[model samples]
Target: MTSIAHSAAVSAALRDGKPVVALESTIITHGMPWPQNVETARKVEAAVRAGGAEPATIAVLDGVIHAGLEDSQLEAMGKATGFLKLSRADLGYAVATRKNGSTTVAATMIAADRAGIRVFATGGIGGVHRGVEKTYDISADLQELARTPVCVVCAGAKAILDLPKTLETLETLGVPVVGYGSDEFPAFWSRRSGLAAPMRLDDPADIAALIRARAELRLDGGVLVGNPIPLADEIAANEINPAIEAAVDEADAMGISGKALTPFLLSRMLDLTQGRSLIANIALVENNARLAAKIAAAL
Candidate 1:
């Protein structure tokens, strides 16, 4: 197997046995616009550090798999155009071609596992799209969760996805989904997705214990920690549901398919919501990062 190189700061943190939380880079490259994207990335990293863990934001740049990035790199990536949104299928391709790419949930899990980081924080996980019956579209994240041992913390699957189907798919894959502090699974921009979670965990210590137990049992898959957005920051299901439906409908009408669908829908939602969606996204990501840092510290 090829050895993965960690950044100098990440290597030092790993060597010193400090808590380290893995983060994905797509949110910096493809998820948002410039300035705010870089700003939010820094704030999320700060949140992790405040909760006593080192943040390692993973990405592939110029054929090198970076476990963490410097401020300049983060800024440049946020402003750069034409970066690929990488998953398991194309992560190697991006590296092989020496292209700059942002890590998706699946790619991040793979990188985090290799780096021996047990926890990752992200805004949301991709899942079954609403029209998957015809498009057969599903995110690689579900399969990655089934195989990788790195616990992932997210608000939930993106609100635009088919929540019940996503949950069912995760169940079928034998991946544990734990709703943090609530019985209801959270939607990305909203506090609740109207579906009951398979399990609920109210404490960070208990979450850490669950992860340790899973490792002890030699489980192959990771755990899903569904942390809801703060009520103050949430957009409410009713208000956002219509916007999401309109975005999906527009994508279908335009014949947008495959990997392009997500970014397209998200971009539409950002405009339709007058940028409120982006605000909620940043808040939930920060919330997940803080919780993930605590769990990483405990582990």
Candidate 2:
């Protein structure tokens, strides 16, 4: 049987009690074009290292689960085609089949927990789709957060999702949504989601303290740290909402649903927004990576 983690650096760091931040790999395989995807991956990893932690970019390659990827491995994955977009339901199947796979938020949480990592960073999380009431298409990311013992730092749930429903579901699951250094929840490309966060933590140490408290209380779930995108890079909610709505409507009209829906919406939004959305995405992810590194160090 293949073990949980195959990265020697990650294994050694875990054994040595060093700070390590878990990273998802779908950003490389499904989030962007080749060279840019590889470049962004390297930048995010560098940001984590600059903030005083090791970056474990999780992926599954030919049946082995890698907790950290080398630059060559990242380049290969970025250029490769037909990699599985793995979530909780299919992660095991991909491993068993000896296939190449990119880890989504849920899959990354599962791998991070198994590797004993306490913090993860990503661009944004998947959530309830806009018409989820009819489609019943909630992302497995929410359920993973309800049980995984890791702190996830992100801009927020993707703006393409139903932010209100996602927040409500997180509350129902007892997952704490902490807005880092901000009062309003972030809306992926926008700095504000126009919704209040369930909680707020101003410092990395305080967030780490909260995680420790959760452990003390024997809580089995993770926390969501909503770090807003940099003000300079954000496309204010008012400016971005129309584009998002149009993309959602287009997806619905074309019968785009399930895992295919998010990518489709994002692609349309990128075009509608003149590629600004992708730039904002890169900035926010790097910011989250830095904060996650700090939290992991404090832990």
Candidate 3:
């Protein structure tokens, strides 16, 4: 295992067998504008703490993997620029090369599992892109879920991708998708993706039980909890789908693909929706954090 630097709080929690929720650093470095990104990260951590769990925001800095970040580290990461958007493929490369980088869902999961953390919270997991046939641009996140044991709590696949294909791929991977109080899988900013969730478990304790059951059965993958955005905070599918379509089309036209595609589409969404998308994103991320904390406690 790679050497990991644990923050004081995370070390204490792990030593004491306390609940802890893993958070990703890309949400701070690549997901939003600086101050809000830092502020939202703090709020999400607070939400975890409020739910009776410690927060472990994972990142890689100067050839070291950090299982938890301190306040100053969080601020620096938020303000830093030109960091790699790391996933499974390049996580080790960044560490080996001593480069600063932000961990995406896949990379975060790998790090969390290495640190003995079993739960994570994030805004959404990436999945099959719209043009998976031509581009084959699937995100590493799905594969991570298939092989890693850390449970992930997210709003769902990002709205910019093909939700149907994403769900199909998860099914093929044998990763359980559980809805947290909804039969339908959430579409990131929206409460409904119009796709029925494969399994529904309303209570966090029940979700924890499901995780335990999987462990007992010796399942190879993690569980995904599709947590919907709050009603007041959600941008209805009707209102947001058009913007998503437009942004995806524009990316295709502009020749943006692979790692650049999501950030491009998301930045375009901020412009097209006049920042409503960002507001919803922050809300959903915090919401996932709180729920993840509860699930961690139950576990």
Per-model lDDT: 0.94, 0.93, 0.95
Model 2 over residues 19-114: C-alpha lDDT tens digits?
A: 999999999988887687899999999999999899999999997888999889999999999999999999999988899999999999999988
Clashes of each: 0, 0, 0
Ranking by lDDT: 3, 1, 2
Residue range 219-291, candidate 1, lDDT tens digits: 9999999999999999999999999999999999999988898889989999999999999999999999999
Residue 126 C-alpha lDDT in model 3: 96
The digit string of per-residue lDDT tens for model 3 on 1-299 reads 57899999999999999999999998888889879999999999999999999999999999899998999999999999998999999998999899999999999999999999999999999999998999999999999999999999999999999999999999999999999999999999999988999999989999999999999999898999999999999999999999999999899999999898988898899999999999999999999999999999999
For model 3, how big is the CA root-mean-square deviation? 0.7
Clashing pairs in 1: none
Q: Any runs in candidate 3 off by more than 4 Å, and if so which?
A: none
Ranking by TM-score: 3, 1, 2
- Model 2 misplaced stretches (Cα beyond 4 Å): none
Judged by lDDT, which candidate is best? 3
**Judged by lDDT against the true structure, how good is candidate 2?**
0.93
